[model samples]
Target: MKLYWSSRSPFVRKVMVFAHECGLAERIVCVRTVVAMTKPNVDLLPVNPTGKIPTLLLDDGSALYDSAVICEYLDSLHGGPRLFPESGPARWTALRRHALGNNLTDNLMLWRNETLRPQPQQSPEILAAFELKVRNAVAALEHEAAALAADPVSIGHVAIACALGYIDFRFAALDWRTGHDRIARWYETFARRPSMVLTAHVDQ
Candidate 1:
């Protein structure tokens, strides 16, 4: 399998973390690619109309898209403990947390993009809305921080970690750690995992 990869993409990092956790990392080859919101990757258009990185090209020539689908597909290939919990309350809880984390990530990315636009072109209303979403979501996560590390690893955990990581990388000025002591501690321990250490973001 070939993966359209990027060091700076949290979504791509999530897929790679899943692969490594499944012990299937060696079977795939990473093809570094870059894509931006306003600027599309023309070469990637034929394969994925969205021109998104983290697109997985399987051996049979089928392509999988976006982080959520790709992670679920990769989980199916592994027989060990699943990244997505199976049916039951555990499943719903994981899904709920994953939704929260993923949405937070989406808003963070949107906020970052808004901030990058030339001052005159940026929409203050849009930026404020996204920033509010991020703050509220992080507060919810901080409130439930104790439970975050209690269960076995799940895709939800992966999602949360990546969301937090992106904030650390791109919005250090936000100082998310303030007053979110429990989550801060939880993140410190979680970030030590081999997958995270290997995938840590470095500015390009």
Candidate 2:
């Protein structure tokens, strides 16, 4: 399997962490790829029309894009720890957390793009609304962290950790830790994991 990704992408990091946690890290070959929302890399266009990073090229020649789908596929292979639960309530909880994490990341990405735009082109109203979503997402994560004392290492947790890491990487000035100390603490510990340390950050 060939995994094309950008080291700094939170979504890509989620798949990497999941691969390590599932003990399948060595099975896939990691290929560094560049992808920009405005102008994506030409190399990726041939494989995926969306030209997104974290695209998985299977040995059989099938390709899978999107980090969530890739991570789920990797999880199914080993069945080692079961990143996504097999049954009812637990599965729903994990999926909900995972969705929340993804949504948080989505808003963060939007906030970042808006910031990159010229000051005159940026919409203050849109930025303000996205900032509020980010804040609410952090609060939601703080509540979730309070319940994860066991450090279950589910798909949701991995995604959430990556989301927090992205904030640290790009929006460090944002100071998300002010009132959401619990989530910050959770991330502090989570970020120290071996997988995270290995694929920490990459400069563009």
Candidate 3:
């Protein structure tokens, strides 16, 4: 399998972290693919019209896009414990947590794009809204920190960690760890996992 990957994308990191956790990392060939909001990658459009990184190219000439979809596919390939629970309350909880984390990541990316615009073009209202949402999300995570630590690791955990990791990577000025001690402590341990340590973000 080949993955259109970028060192800076949190979504891509989510998938890579999942792959590593499932012991599928070595099977994937990471092909550095650069993409940006303003400038799309024409070469990538042929394979993934959205021109998104983390698009997976299968050996049979097929493709899968979206981190969540690619992650479920990889989970199917592995025989060990599943990151996505198969049924019942566990499944719902994991999916809900994944949604929360994924949405937070989306907002952070948007916040980043907004910040990148020339100051005159940036929207103060949008920036403020993003900041508020991020704060709310972090507080929610802090409340769930104990549950997260007690549960078996899931895709939810991976997504949340990636989201937090992205903040550290791009929004360090936010200093998210200040009051969210529980979640911050949870992340400190989660970030040490081999998957995270191996795929740490790079600016370029």
CA lDDT of 165 in candidate 2? Answer: 89
Best-performing candidate as measured by TM-score? 3
Q: Residue by residue across 77-137, what tens digits does model 3's lDDT show?
A: 9999999999999999999999999999999999999999999999999999999999999
Better of 1 and 2 by TM-score: 1
The model with the greater TM-score, 2 or 3, is 3
**Which of 1 and 3 is the better model by lDDT?**
3
What C-alpha lDDT does candidate 3 achieve relative to the native structure? 0.97
- Over 27-57, each residue of candidate 2 has an lDDT whose tens digit, in order, gives 9898988777888789888888889878999
Among residues 3 or more apart in sequence or in different chains, the pairs in candidate 2 whose N, CA or C atoms overlap within 3 Å are none
Displacement of the residue 181 alpha carbon in candidate 1, Å: 0.5
Q: Which TM-score value belongs to model 1?
A: 0.97
Q: Over the stretch 1-204, how does candidate 1's per-residue lDDT look in tens digits?
A: 999988898888888877888878888898988789999999888888899988999999989998899989989998899989989988988888888888888899889889999999999899889888888888898976888879888888888999999999999999999989999999999899988988888666
Best-to-worst ranking by lDDT: 3, 1, 2
